[model samples]
Target: MHTNTSTLAASAVDRLRQEIFDGQLPPGTRLAEAAEAKRLGVSRVPVREAFAALERDGLLEFTETGRTVVKQLTPQDFEELFAMRLLLEPAAARSAFPLSRKQQQLLSDNISATRKANSLNEVTRLDLDFHQLIVEASGNTRLLKLWRSLRTELELWLGYLHQQHRDRELDTRVDTAGSHEGILDCFQNRSAAACEKLTREHILSWREWLPMAELET
Candidate 1:
């Protein structure tokens, strides 16, 4: 019974998460446990558990009035999120230098799969997976924990960026694959400094597409 309840809760989580990513449940949309439970054909138990899980994933938040709503990310939120990415990812990549042959192959496979991705959502997942594999390879458990904690927020931000690119008819697949290839080359050559620089630059290159107005320093 416990295992079955857990599975139902996990399923509820995935369904709701995808809905949020697909914009079916846009930001600021309120969610109710009983309603979602009915919609998903599960008991209120799983729905309640899923809500708490989504809250931890940063997709849902409780208002001061105690209503559960989808998270509303602002321009400042994007800016702050990217700032954290810049601080951590490049350093993680540097620490992951001299990646093993198996790790290298995994990255190469990820890029190949990304190139063939049919949807922006798939591209976003592959993109994050590429970076995450590097972080995992770093062998720093604490760093990996921190990175995982940011995973869902990063997905939300990157998904929004990809959608914007799609609306503008900008195909970022080629650019993304090329950038990964360049980073892989650095790893192949065992150039930790170059890898760090390239990784940092790769992240900064995405700043142009930010929805935020540039603030004066």
Candidate 2:
């Protein structure tokens, strides 16, 4: 019974997370444990668990009146998060050089998958995973933890950006793959400095892709 409950909670988390990410449950949307449990055909126990997990992920927040609602991201949120990314990711990527064979393979596989991904959601997920693998390869426990803490928010932002691009009929496959290929080449060549420089440049360039004007809408 305990195992079943745990499974249900994990499933609820995935469902709720995808809904939130897909904009089905947009920011500021009220969420009730009872209603969500009914909708997911699970008991309130699992829904409560899911709620706690999402709150930890920075996707759910309680209002002054104690009503739980989806967190509304602001332009400032993006700026602040990207600022931290600029600090954390490049440093991590710098140290990630001379990666283990396993790490290299995983990153290579991720980029290939991203290139072939049919859905924007898949591409966003793989894109984030590519960065995550670099940070993990750095072998710094604290740095990995810090990066994981920001991952969900970064994912939400990237997903939004991808959707905006799609709406504008932009195909990002080439640019995204091209950037990763360059970084991977640096890794292949064992140039840590080049990797760091390219990684920083890659991240900094996202400011151009940021959907600043769409934040209010």
Q: Cα-based RMSD of the predictions, in order?
A: 2.8, 1.9
Write down the lDDT of every candidate, Cα atoms only: 0.85, 0.85
Model 1, 97-150: lDDT tens digits are 989999999999999998898888888888889999999988888888888888
- List model 2 lDDT by residue over 157-211, tens digit each: 7776666557632357767777887888889986888888889998898777556
Question: Model 1: residues >4 Å from true position, as ranges?
Answer: 168-170, 212-217
What's model 1's TM-score? 0.92
TM-score of each: 0.92, 0.91
Clashing pairs in 2: none
